[model samples]
Target chain A: MSAPSSPVPAPLGSRVPLAGLAVALGALAFAVLPLLVPTYQVSILTEILIFAVLAMAVDVLAGFTGRTPLCHGAIFGVATYVVVYWSQQGGAPVTGVLLAVAAATLVAAIFGLLAIRTSGVYFLLLTLALGMIVWGVCLRWTSVTGGENGLRGTVRPELLAGHLPFYYAVFAVVGIITCVMWRFVRSPFGLTLRGIRDSESRMRALGYNVSLHLFLAFTISGFFAGLAGALYAMFNDFVSPSTVALSQSVEGLLMAITGGIGTLFGAFIGAAAIIGLENFVSQYTERWQSVLGLMFILIMIFAPQGVIGRVRDLLTRRR
Target chain B: MDRRTFLKTSVAAAAAGAVAMPHVARAQGGPIRIGLMAPLTGVVAAGGREMVDGFNMYWEEHGNEVAGRKVEVIVEDDAANPDTALQKARRLVEQANVSMLFGNLLANTGLAVANYVKGNGMPYFIPIIAADDLTQRNRIKNVIRVAGYTASQFPRPLADWALKQGYKKVATISQDYTFGHEQCGGFCQTFTEGGGKVLGQFWHPLNTSDFSPYLGQLANLGADVVFAMETGADATRLMQQYANFGLKGQIPLIGAMNMTDQSVIRTMGDEVDGVVVAAHFAEGSPAPVTQSFVAAYGKKFGKLPSLYGFSMYSGAMWVDEALKSIKGNAEDRDAFLASVMKTDLTGSPLGQTVKMDDYGNPIYDVHIRKVVKNKDGKYWNEPIANYPNVSQFWKYDPVTYMKQPPYSRDFQGIKKS
Candidate 1:
């Protein structure tokens, strides 16, 4: 049988200049965004970047491995709690980051081990159950997690205390992570994951350790999610049970889907759309939730493959 | 017109309108803009609406002007999340350009906003958040709780009453949170100090749909009285389930603030009657000030104003008093805060002359109330007893209290007298 075609078409040589120009222009806009907007809007932009990292994590498993893990919110939440807990205990920021990411990676490894054996809906259910367990722990473990009130008193490192500086710090971290994720999804290991997504049995017959590969992909996704969570904990200087709630997981998934699953950069677009709509739309109308719901429905109907996916489809048709 | 020309014309119009809006607002004598943040669209939306209504009612009575300045309240929904509350606080201060900040429902949101406002030096008045640290260890000068009590403040009176009634053993079932812990801690501290034994304590997560599990365990505890701490929907469900489990009248039921609050009691049936609670305000108060406030609120909203509404109403009065003293010049932040701190409200709906303590918390009477159906056949909190001039530290020395850690699940303040 012939090899399976890639979901995204290979970039045309003639389109290279346009893509490079677009990338450079987008970067320039983001770099100067804080200066253009009000301080409050800068905070909103920082939140979008952090959440975009979370969306990218969700896309990693859902778009590449064909496994939609519902527990990444819990993974992100664990890191947030770790950072807050560490800071509350007077730990340094660098060490807090190390501990937070390590804790998140460990939680992800355990969840992956339990879930990698299952596929399709079973995998989703298991991850959901694990996520619920984490939520329950966050709620009941009153001392460490601060129960429902959550742990407060997180001091931003003295260097990035100001709003503009903090926004840039988040921008830099998210920028680096995005580059790393971009490379990860295109690597040979990422190709095998995609191959498994297309035909798991075929990949297994080809002597690939499917569970191990899936486990590694899940852990890497958790690492990025943890980094985002760390940034979020610092940005908000607070963490609560809402961070680990089921709605958070669903929102991350929605962002990935709305941007274009499997397209890493689409996560950023999706994050911007969701964050912008939630904040700015509410300013204009009290029925903003209804407006948001309506937008989601329109997107699903008009662009089922998401905004980026539809754009790519249009470009392919032109060819 | 063609599409390009039409677009250009509309864009120019929109830009002109945007630029002209603030000038128009300023032309209206620069109304005293207060940013009111509440959980307007979340689990506590009902309570949040009541807060806004109560606050607005005061301004409405004065024709939307306070102290000769047109009061424009820009309400932003925090959705009961701390992060969202902080963001809204920033938007209110930096973008909306509100001179003052008011209204927060949850303790976490209150603390988050208080911290942010403290840094920004905005005058924030909390009407209904009961977080202890807001006025205790971490008190911020710019942040004042105008018409609110600490979570533990009201419970102290209830504990004293329970002991006077000769109840020797007590059990507590509270929502597992800081608010819950503080409420239970205060009660237990007073009860144990008076030789009452706390047989057991049970905590359930917030928004717990079912109370059967906790009720079943409580039945076995066989305490002389059971003190419950819950709020909003959880309080309504717990009261209903307590009766359903056949444990309602078997043991005396005492509640912390908000369990039998007007907001929750309105939703509850006869199962909640006779339950004792401690709160700063009782809607069924016989005082002339409360009666008039209740009559006006009922005539307009067609319901008894809950504690949420009463607090905001009184909080508005406090702000009005302060603004009137300073000639409505909220632009002078230091003078505004000084005027606010010196406020002595005599006709508050809380049925007391409210005054601020040194710690930026209110010092007022906490009423021991019982749930009862009034002549209108509607349930309301009826004042049974009053603890006059109650403070956040209760009877404990302020220095000693500050030295001790804030109340938590592990530290229930079981004083070994």
Candidate 2:
């Protein structure tokens, strides 16, 4: 989708070095952030990074595959509940992670099968309905989900218990996952998915299994979303119905849109913007929601392609 | 002076001033900062606003000072979301450096805050959340519910009243969350114990716009009375729909806490008249303390103080009393929490002495109130019966009560005969 905007690509010789430098600089900044900020702000930064992963997962479907899977929130939430429930049952953190990932992937596979058959608004509605089913289960299944009060008492592992260590651990995990997703989106399969997105009939004529490619893309997206959810559950050590709610799904999509949907790094920028605005702006004004809404409106109006897309456009135009 | 010298001197002076700021602040003995988290936006904004008003009214009346130290409240909007609540809580404790934490309006937010506060060991006094396990199975040592009651606390007394009124068979309808389950569980437990049967029970989602489907099932039940557990706008919608369905007069409606609370009842019409509900506070109580509070609140806020407002108002008073006991040394966390737990508030606005239970919950009067129109053409909860010195455990021993599972949809359901 962003290809047409870039009429001329930068030479690979210069692009590689520049991209590497940017990655190194970004990693170094995140590594030092906890030491620089207040103790509370470090937690906020950790949350931003975790949510950035979810936003990237949204981008995997919405940006590259040309299908918006609203059920990604439920996939994320399913992992969270799985991890919390597992930990509460005395499972180790590593085992809990596997369980959470597998559960989230399974749910995503089922949702993909059901929703992949449809496209456009039908796909959106199907995904929404599927997500609501998960939410309803989380709410009504009081025996497991604890109803509205939610499941609590998941202690952080001793190794990552402290704020600094936990932040660093999250930083490392999120860093590794972002790199893997970066590779996935650049792979041949990713190209095929994008091809299908641009023209499903052409991709089909070219011998690509369109539905299979879309399904695989969705499942991979759910994998990253589940990992993010597991990290979040560890970060907060609490999970509630709110985690699986429709608002959560909407927020993830907003993050993706605000950050520039297809740009992988834009997810982090979007997460930071929304989280920062919610935390800091609220301290200064009681009408923070209005302020956030206004900011969103301005962004949508001025940079419809999103913050990163606009930045990229400006950079390319200058070049 | 040259421009360089002038600029250098100004910069040096500014740096020195910044360095000296902390010492100056310490010398002044910083104000006792209390962090309040509430749903200042979203669905429960009205209840959240009233809670803040009531809390501030108490402090405002006392000049915002407690035991020679100034009191400063930092209010944060949680947006009724648990994650946001936890984030705001961290901001309050670590960033704002509040001496204590107060205010949460929903069960989810309350539990989230309690969990976070447990790790930090911050003294948190919940004013409005009614989650049962906060005081029951999962009581946190550092968390105290000053003006809060468990979801089941108010309804337990109403159950006995229902049975006494010859309502042998009853139907129940409540919001399908922790609070609702616990509320219905409490009433059913006591009602069934008193030889009354709960014929049917209906659980609806929060913010349910239509109660017609549930009302349809209710009409077929042919039960002696219908007990409803709803709050805020849900209560208003349920009552209005009940009247629309012509089920109000046909079946006696018994509400759980805040069903016809002053905040919601004012929006309702005559259909709510004579509906019986039980709550910890009655806005229309003729007691001197309550009357004075009503008059002062009306003069200031131009409305009756709902249960939300009254709870926070009394919570502020409780905190003030605790601070006075410690001579306002809120910085001494252990001493302050100890003082809070040892509180025995006599002549509180509830028209009785409010005492603290062993599990960090309050033991106070539960009033069985009836909705009525006053001479001023306002609907108020009139105290029809008062159950004095009620605990969250009701009639059972705390140890025995703790042995049973925390109330859920099926755990305390009526037995099928």
Candidate 3:
């Protein structure tokens, strides 16, 4: 494989500062949203924050590394169940959180290893198979996961028990993580990942270990996905097998694509759209699912770059 | 301004105006809101539809008013998932500010909702789900199980009747879940204690398409009777395969009420003949209330009301009775709960009087019925036996029964062929 004679330049100049300002303002709004909005909106926004992280994880794999792994939801769910079950069985909060994150990373590593060998559709299929295995375990292992009923009444500490504090906690964690991810993508390592996405053989020829980088990328994505899951378990005060199912993985991927494949902020926009549709739109009509599908279709046809990406592009073009 | 700018500003103003208008309208006059969460989609859509219809039937009959106040029900489809059920419950309680909550079809969803309501200190009337833990170890004061026969309660009377009939050997086939485990456990425990011989028992997955494999084992065991606990379409599919395997009439099939639901029996046609099951409600009862409900439900839904539909209808009646007793006052939750506890739904959908047990469960009639062809060639469950004022723990001490573990898939007492 040959690289383009004239490689596409990195995003730089005036656009970078403007994007930074936008992100900062977004963070400020998210931090203040709970205080201003109703408890229901706060709850919905918390979920959006958590799902945004998961969607961004998907964006890293599918957008940067050019691989779509369907097991990310399973990775998320495994972490949640581990933390929830541990907490339910009298484990300390910090220890439970650590174990959950570690478990997610380990599952991600295993799933990544299996999927890294395969490219394109095979990667998606392999990850889906892995995700199904996790879902089955959650369903059948009633002793541990509470089977189909799901493990509930998870004991969260006093600090994070209330909705207001919990939303802030999610906001702070997601905000820091998003900043880290922003820097990671703009760094040399991130550039190398984009290079791999552009042309794998060319990158391999330039002394980059392609599979190792991709595997690391997958593991990192899983780490963030797991973080989101652990927070989700705490937020919901319950964990279920549905969290590990293929539908959830598909949702993450859909959010990434809908937000704009390669854009980081697009993940958040996409999550907001999906979660808002489920919560707010469903309140108005019984056929909200159909309406959601129609919205997605319209977004795909008209705003092909995604809500954030298209808005950003239009702003830059106008300038 | 340009056309586009003018159009955008007008639309934005209209949206803002619309959002601000609702609170004013609500403040002037609002109905007492009751929220319902059910699996209105997914695999249980049929059951969900039936339950909602039952709830609506009562309101429609009474002109959508309880006492002097208007009653409004807000329904949310939970998709039969526990997580979604809880989420919808939160939306109902916190967001919609519903005064009361009711209706959940699945046991797990009921438990999840129970936890939420108990935590929030809300009055919840559970009509359909009969999981024992809801009334036993997991029992919370605020949750009122309207038709409170647990899965265990369904099978005890059947086991007693089986012993009376001198059926010594008992084989069980049940769904592999919380509901099925309790059902088969109750039957096996009671039957074994009553001098019945032990036989093979099979716990199949909830969505087993082919029961031939399990039926083969049942054939080999050759028990005197099979106490099966498959429900909904699974029961229909299992009976169809049981007939296909020529074991329908050969084996005396006794099951929970789910097996011979009016809908399931209709689907299976005449193949489900003579299949005895135990339940709280039956179609062919001599009670005038039963006959009236059967007619009213049929006319409204264009189909016969199943156990779920009947229970939901009864739940509405009980709610109405309780509300009327309190003069439609739901604001004081403690008083509302007291009224609910005092509710005796006589002349309601189930065709018998009922009251809450000491544990917030129900003390109601349990019917052991057989699937028989009617004069019109339609199949209905004809009662062969009835147990009145049955509690969730039957006659056993609640403390003693609570000591034993809830029945699960891998109980050690079962004997395999």
Candidate 4:
């Protein structure tokens, strides 16, 4: 099915006090969750935060550039493997994470340079192929990657030993990353990319280096995504071919579209809803996938623009 | 029809109830909680489900209580993903507060879980995964495997039996994962040590659908026997293609346990006739415990248990024996570990008494069986030979085995027998 024809109404004008109050209340509630809830709930929240970061990276392409990458998870997974391999070889954690992010961004830049020449269906297919190549390497390079047995034994920092401490660390990291991404999408570069999205030929005719802007945007997104993946690999202390599989990439895409495109906070809200439903629903019934699918269908049918987008439209119309 | 509106309301109602109800019912329990982490939904879902069923049947038979305490089972689906397995295990240990962990079916999941339990000091039992590293390179204090032979141990008897049958030269076809590498390496190492010539060895990628190229290469090798180590879908496809390639009876076929497992045997029919394998569990054993288990499992699940199901059932039974000896108080961790390590699992369907070595790997009989139609006119693996009291290293010294490189595709060290 196609995206909704009507675009989301941007809330970029003078800040409304009601929206600010809602944001404050949401932050307060999230802060108190670990203090009150069970450890399992805190773990679920950690997963949501990681996926939210991943969704924001997807938004850079799908929401801003009007290009959907089917292999962004592969980029994320490549960084994870890099960090895992480094740490397994007795490298320090800080250096391992840095090296991982740099490697992942480099791979993403190469991907963007190759895929920038293609558009539409070709872009999606090319990214899919690239992602599968990462998975194939992970599965075939048994000596280094452990093949299908998966690589384990990464050390977790003692500072983040407890569940609450890890959750807070994840919260702090994702919060800082999201704020930077917010400034990025609001910058002149971001706006020019949006214009290119509307009419690339017109932008090129106006002497804009459209290809260079798109490539940079893709690389920057990949950098932040690599950061997210490195944290995820450390959090689980394990890395496998599944982390880089196509299913994970599609999962990120679904989280972005289902949360609301073009909105930064909406990615987190979408992540919270999806991860919460998946973890919670599976507890009561093994047919949780069916229920999750049902929820997705209902959302697509009624709230075609996504839950956050639909809410924003209602508020805009009321005002 | 306002389907959108209806769906919207139903979705909201269902989401609110399903998502919110579990948290509210979190009162502390009275039973001794045992957590089972298995692949409930994935490529290995069928085997996982059967394993769960086997454990459940045994639990019910014992009245769902052990040593006068109510037994509570917390079932978590890992979906066969190593990352997910670790997450679910953490939830089980931290949230469910389970006393013990059980049933990790896949190899990587087992390794990851083994690592987690080792650090956390959780009492864990692995029933099915056969990667040799679990008992060798990755062995820890609190973890033990009660079911199935290690990948290296499985091929010892099969290689010896093949040599006894006068098949000297051999060709091997195995998947390229850890299980595959161990299987091919173990068989080749042992077969060569038995005064046999290795004509060829081929390693195929996991989930390979087309085996014609591998088969053609094997057909040209002129070996007297072909030893294979494919499992599940790969095994079925390889056997079917082997038949079409007209090499079924021209050369004898032997393999690790899973080549003719219960899950794939019926689909193979006469194609597997006279094919020999070394497995821990065989359906045609005539021991009283074997007959009873077969009858009860068949009655309960409408068929004989899959190797996974039987192994898990045996694992649960071991847990029961341990629990009875300790009277269900799992609080003293060291005492419980001692009791579990000393528990004797003898006189079962597996045909001999079982004991754990220093690394918590089982030392039991490995049945070298050949497939044939039984008196019931059904295909069964009848034991043609036995390697009793075999350890994980298959008679190799533990220190020397540890000194050698762990089995991989390129491994070439097998001591002369």
Candidate 5:
């Protein structure tokens, strides 16, 4: 089904305030949640913030670069654990995080370049294979990776022993990154990238470095993915290959699609929806995944653009 | 809808997906209605399904049903991930209205669900997934872990073997994660406590394919009896590498948790032999209960249960036996909980009396098992020694493990009923 798109009769400039107001409410809701909701809710919120960063990374790749990459979670998860592991060996956490990100960015760039040689499902398949390969390695390589026991620890400083500080820390980072993403989407560079996304050959004819742009976009996406991983490693105090598994990678796609791919808020919104629904469903049924599967199927069949897209359409229609 | 409208509509439609009213599950029949959540599918499918089967088998023979109501086991798949495990637990507690919740194999998931269940005032019991901290620092009320914590099983065996081999300057290479790091830490702690020196430690990405670097470093470290902590496919791979490096016989590898687990035996076959790891349970635990379990399991599934499967089998029956002891009173949340905390079951697979410590971890025998080929020509883990009646939580005092993380201190679950 076509998404409801009444030209945001309001220019994005005017809409920014509305979005800002919405974001403000969200932040406020989050701030008040610890008091009103249970500890379980707090844990779920922590998860949402982590995925928000992940989904935004995907937006840069699929929405801006217009390339469908499947193995981004692998890059993020690997970088996160490796960063933490290296740091334990007298490596600095910040430097470890940075190096892990840089390494993952390079890996993603190389993989993207090679996989981009093919398009459509073939490309998807290659990335999926890589993700599975990483997962297998995580499962197999014991001595170095802790095997399946997974990398566990406490990612707390003195300040993070309590929940509130960690919650806000995650929020601030996610909000700042989203704002940064907003700027990137509006920049000339972002516009040209969008142009490349729309028609790579035409953009190339217009003197754009298509491969370089794609490579650059891939690296940036990987960087953000790495950042998410690093944050996650600190948040959960552990990292496992499961985070980078194909299923996890697919979960990121589900979050993006569930919230509406192109919209920046949609990424977080989708994460909220999926994570929220999961929390809610699990609170009620052991068969929550079947419910989730049904929910996703209905969305695909009816609101292809997902909950956010459908909501936006309804408001415009009412107007 | 045009492009703009389509996008807008999609957003609106997405928003429309918000839930209408919150759902709640009321309590139903109570056969100590415990929700059993574990990995029923995926990579650990074989192990998980067997574990679930063992739980059911026990429930079948021994369950009395809570308060005269038929006991129901809400078997849910954890998918061996934290997020999914949490969800399944919620369903069992809220939707199914099970009085108690059970089953979490991984550490984070165990911590996550135990914390959640304790908050909601429902008792959650864990059959497997034995990280030291679960009972040590992260104890939650309404959370009873029946199995011995895995980390507690290692130190003595690791220390003894290291000393026997006259090994010093040890180095550990584990999967770079919590389970590996913590258990390996326990290993080093025990080794050093026994007058051994640790040279260095290395952890690799959990999903690494190449181990040339890990092995090369191990060769450089020159430590006797290299300690390995890995499970499932990872253990199998490391075992292969250990043999490939000619370190299996020469270096005398001692693995406490994953090295001699069921997954290792099945995954690596003949190569599994000679791998010594610390464990408290084995197929040959020697009790009539364990022997009967092996017999029944063998007759039914054409094989003997592994240490994990055997533990899970004993665990389920243990719960069933506890329920029977308390009878229908298990439906009473407080009464049932008190009964659960006071669990002291014997003649089970581990062939040792399992009495609850002040905290939930088992203060029972710790065994060192060596992988050996059985008459069936398949690798099986046989217990070489039983360190009977050892406290699983060595680092912490008895008072500590009862009220730990994932829960607040003074938590009622470990309040020593």
Candidate 6:
């Protein structure tokens, strides 16, 4: 079909020091945060970790793959309910959590495949629609989902021991997920996805299946999103449709942008800043949600690359 | 990272864990632990804090002692959101180790804790937030309520108030939720009973900031009276919008106290005057107890206290006082929850004695209050009439009401169909 498409880049699997360093730092913070902050803040941090995982998944689809899959929140909620239902049915909580991610991956696979037929804004709308469908299902299907009353999210059984042990468990899992994602983003598949994002028609002419690549990338993202949801469901001991609403989906995007979408550590930093700010702001102002929204808008305007990503861009650009 | 250093750190961590573990255990205490989960840090945080103050004052006057131990009131925020309410419930049960959980200031919060406490087997007695279903059909066992259910004293009392005022035609406007539905349902049940007709019906999203359309809809109905249910900022905004439509002066209005509380009246200004509201207690309730509460509450907080504070105070006191009756080990789950479940008798500060049936709703009096100008220049609630034994038609059959789907249930006068 005309000019040859750019060759698929080779995987850069040998070493990625930044990702490893981030994990180490995260593990250290995980150990320290509980000691330093109150139980409430620790609870808040645990939530941040959950959201960070979900945001990273969104970043993978939006940044690495360049096709925005916004239905990540709903997919995450779907996983959460699965975990919740399993737990209620006497399934091991951990097994239920894992199943949540698996189910999410399948949903993402199907959604992604259906969505790949569209491009750009159409792709975004498809994801949004899919997310709303999940919200509607959760809202209308009250017998199972609890409707607006919401299922009582019970106290999660601590895996290792208590709060500190729980932190380490989340950190280890998050670190591994991040490492895998980091590797994937720099691999040949990552490069091809980027290429497709940059020029999908050209890739199609080059005989590469753009839809397959996009679907796989989205499926992987959904897997992580589902994992985060399962973790959250177990952690909070509750699941509701509000968790999967369009607002949460938007907040995930905000997290990615606030942290620097392309960077691996951005999601963690974003989650931390957002959650920590929310906690502090709530203590001071009754209008904290509005204040957080303002901060989000400011970040959009001023720190659009996210704190870490912006710093990275600036330092790299200067050099 | 050496063995000696690692051992020291491990010991330190273990010691810290040891210290925290007792707090978790101490929560399951000898004292009657009354957990107060409300929206203490959101938009209604002001009212929530006020409620907490009222509760703390009641505890303080009673020597802050219940069940012979220092009463520890664990205050947590439900964020006026159901999800947060659920989380706070887990925190209260697992961490706070509360003997009895009480006082929900938000409708969804009460519903959330009601459902959750069912599993915890804690007698979660809610009195402040009147979400009818919580007491009616959604009445979870081990959860008793001292507050009036939305269904019991709705549409009827106010609808009658309208009929008494000689306004035969009425219109309804409310937030679209379980609480609003029940309030309207109750009003309709009573209104229609006396042959009063509701001419207009309008519903708006809970998150809606605009009431122009709904206000205009009610205005266009040409009804002699407007009976509505709106709360917090929504109430303030809706009333202001209602005033703009010139319905405040043109049409007589009667709504649930939630439609316009102390905050709403203060914010809604001239529009608040002549607005009739049916409630358990009002700012200027003729009862000497209410006057003292208002004085004590104002002295403590420097503002008129909302019904939230009143209900929360009663809820906390009900638990604190009920624990006194059992005199068993406060931490004994069976003894304490059972003691609370025996709260079929409620003799509290707010005028009427609350009698909770098996399903935990107070089968007690509901009142008809109206906004009238007092010497204070500010419009204060004056309890012009009282329905001493008024309760939901289904009050005696709480289990029956509780068995119905929350959606299928209606306020006493409101239509289930």
Best by lDDT: 2
Query: Sort by lDDT, best first: what order?
Result: 2, 1, 4, 3, 6, 5
Model 3: colliding residue pairs = none
* Leading candidate by DockQ: 4
Q: Model 3, A172-278: lDDT tens per residue?
A: 89988898888877789988998888888999999999999999999999999999898888877678888898888988988887787777778987897788667
Residue B242 lDDT (model 1): 92
Q: Report the Cα interface RMSD of each model, rounded to 1 decimal.
A: 5.6, 7.5, 5.8, 5.1, 8.1, 8.6
> What shift in Å separates residue B354 of candidate 3 from its native position after superposition?
1.2
Better of 1 and 6 by lDDT: 1
Best by TM-score: 4
- Locate the minimum summed-lDDT window of 10 residues in model 2 chain A: A1-10
Can you give the DockQ of every candidate in the order shown? 0.36, 0.43, 0.38, 0.50, 0.13, 0.16
Please report, in order, the local distance difference test score of every candidate based on alpha carbons. 0.85, 0.86, 0.81, 0.81, 0.68, 0.70
Give the per-residue lDDT of model 1 (tens digit) for A171-289: 88888998898789888998898888888999999999998999999999999899988888898778888888887888888898888777777787788888877876566555668
Show the colliding residue pairs in model 4: none
Off by over 4 Å in 1: A1-7, A11-14, B1-29
Residue range with the least summed lDDT across 10 consecutive positions in model 5 chain A:
A1-10
Name the 10 consecutive residues with the lowest summed lDDT in model 3 chain B: B17-26
Cα lDDT for residue B154, model 5?
59
Over 4 Å off, model 2:
A1-14, B1-28, B413-417
TM-score of chain B of 1: 0.93
Per-residue CA lDDT of model 2 for B1-417, tens digit only, reads 465864565466345321011111222366998999889988899999999999999999999999888999989999888988998898888777888999989989989999998887999999798888888888898899897888888888999999889999999999887788889999999889889998888988889999999999999999999999998888989999999999979999997967888888877789889999888888888999989999999999999988889999999999999999999998888999999999887656888888999999999788899999988999898899989988999989999889988778777745455
Q: Which residue pairs in model 2 clash with each other?
A: none
For candidate 3, the docking band is acceptable
Clash count per candidate: 0, 0, 0, 0, 66, 25
Q: Against the correct fold, how does model 2 do in TM-score?
A: 0.94
> Model 3, range B42-97, lDDT digits (tens) per residue?
77878888888888888989999987889989999888877778888988877777
Q: Candidate 3: TM-score?
A: 0.94
Query: Which is the winner by TM-score between candidate 3 and candidate 6?
Result: 3
Worst 10 residues of 5 chain B by lDDT: B408-417
